[model samples]
Target: MPVVLSLNIASKTIPVDYTRTGVTGIDKRPVDGPLEVRPPGKKGSSGSGVAGDTIGDLTAHGGDYQAVYGYAREDLDYWQGELGLDLRNGQFGENLTTQGIDHTHARIGEQWRVGTATLEVSAARIPCRTFAEFLGQRGWVKRFTQVARPGAYFRVLEAGRFAPGDEITVLRRPDHDVTVELFFRALTTEAELLPRLLEAGDSVPPQVIELVHKRSVIELDS
Candidate 1:
């Protein structure tokens, strides 16, 4: 059964080498107490769905569509062995460090009932300069993209309170086979797969749909 192994929140901002803002809340730590989860408004105006969690980069980080970030403990363990580092919960800045959930294969729009909150898979976390800098690892972006287990970003469908160790129940899954890994590949390494993302319909980000349309037009012209 899938469960929230750790609920992480950034206690405070810390200085970072990347991003226009000199500070980042990427150093999330597991927190004990229940947290209110809801949509964080729109991008550039909101940060984090968890009430007390911090989002240092508002321009690209937070919104209703990206209310929460979930990374699997299984994937973390894989990286731990490869990197030879003690990768702790929240090390990757994921708000929910989950166990027994195959995030890579979770379909877009799959809904999970965690505690009282309902979360729907919305997008995949793309590696950025901040992520690379936080890890202090060279070529981290390319390396992470190559692995393509970018984790899943979820949108809060029903606001509610939840805490660590809560069991995650799959409420529903979209009928498409466009899994998180496939979506990440389409957006990154596999441009040829972009057209297939359409099968996911509105479950994926609107910008992606628009991009696919634009690509189609360009391809027809050429």
Candidate 2:
């Protein structure tokens, strides 16, 4: 059976914006309607989806931890209360809060359908210094990542809109054998992780695949 879940706009929220590059949409709230989606790419991107050539051009723009795509308003807690976490609600910052869905286990290249919108998991939760700053400590954000296993970021594969309490359901699963959580672990410290991801690069995110390729070359030469 599919993972039935729900997520509220946790205390954290981010937005998709054409202005400001820092972290688009923290103060920008999500509109109440169909959660929009679009093809992934710079062309279809509008805040959250791809770059350009998309639908309404409105979507959750930025959040480092998890991206709610496949389902909504069913699964929560494990990330919020004692079961979930206190990270995004107070740390990394996001646009919408999810009540359900384990951001960490949701693999890359996974396909999810929210209403008419479909999105593909594109990458893992990348821990950056900015996130650390948000949480107000050194390396604090990164540590929270492991503990929270923030959800995955997604690129819109189809166009649609989502609002609070919209019944969400998964239309498909991941396309690869390598899961996002596994990739995160491998990339974080597992020596074999990169190699495994490299060998399985066919299903990894494009940017990640390229990064591994470049690192592999350097490691080989060194």
Candidate 3:
């Protein structure tokens, strides 16, 4: 059973060179909590869904569709071996550091009931200069993209509170093969896979839908 291994929130923003905002909330620290969560409106206007968490980049980071970020502990372990760094929970800027969840393979729109809250897998986290700078890794973005282990971002469907060690129950899963890994690949590296994203229907991110439509138009014109 999947469980929240660590519940994290940024106590404050850290000044950074990579973002337009000149700061980042990527330095999240684990908290002992019954953290409150809810839909955080839209990008540029809203902040993190998790109460007390901060989103320094208002234009790009937090929104209804990306209210909470979840990264699997297994993946962190994999990176620890690859990078020889002491990667800990919340090290990847995830609101929830989860155990026993295959976040990379999780289907978009899959619903999970954690504590009293329900969250739907909405999209995959896109690597950016901020993350690369945070990790102090050269070619971090490209390497992350190549691995396609981009963790899952979720939207709060039912508002409630959750804490570390709370069990995550799969309430439902959309009947689609467009897993988070595939979605990231389609958007980043494999333009050819864009058509497959349609299988996820409305669960697909609006930006990705736009890309798919553009690809169709370009193909037709050619």
Candidate 4:
């Protein structure tokens, strides 16, 4: 049984570029009270975590497919040793810092009953230049990719509120065998695994599906 160790929300501050040492919403702070979670749209386009969390780049960060970001406390512990920094909750830009959930082992499309809402795993958070700059780590993107512990992003299925200490239970799991790690690898370093993504069916992210189609066409043409 996984539990929400902390819930974080970003302030409504002006967006700043994360790369080149600029500020970004990646710095989320813990919220002590319950916050509404819902699908991304005009009213709540930021996605499912806290009501007014700000994302610097809406184009790549917030949306329906990435409504919620969850990271395991265990993984953070491992990174703390490697980075030698006191990494705290929300430091990874995750809305929920979770415990007892094997994020890497979680399959895409797996549904979890978290707090009063139901969320479905949709995609894995890909590292970017912004993340690297935020952490002030040289080659942070490549280093994080090698670790293959990208946290999970989820879509809000049933809108509700969630707070710290909320229990997360697996409500359902898709039959397909596309685990988060496999999907991340295929998307980042393992093009050879692209074709196998077909097994993920509709649960796979549309962007990845498009990439797979393009790869298949190129392979066929060659």
lDDT of 1 by residue, 1-222 (tens): 889999999978898767789899889999986899998887779999988988888988888878899999999999999999999999999999999889999998999998899999988999999999999899999999998989999999999988988999999988889999999999899889899989977777777789999999999999
Rank candidates by lDDT, best first. Answer: 3, 1, 4, 2
Greater lDDT among 3 and 4 belongs to: 3
| All models, RMSD in angstroms | 1.1, 6.5, 1.1, 2.4
Model with the higher lDDT, candidate 1 or 2: 1
Using lDDT as the measure, the top candidate is: 3
Could you tell me which 10 consecutive residues in candidate 4 have the lowest summed lDDT? Answer: 41-50
Cα lDDT for residue 187, candidate 1: 88
Off by over 4 Å in 1: none
lDDT for every model?
A: 0.91, 0.47, 0.92, 0.84
**Candidate 4 Cα deviation (angstroms), residue 22:** 6.8
What is the TM-score (0 to 1) of candidate 4? 0.92
Candidate 1, run of 10 with poorest lDDT: 200-209
lDDT (tens digit, per residue) of candidate 4 on 96-171: 9999998887998899999899998888889998778777899999999999999998888899989999999999
Error at 151, model 1, angstroms? 0.7
Estimated TM-score for each candidate: 0.96, 0.64, 0.96, 0.92
TM-score of 2: 0.64
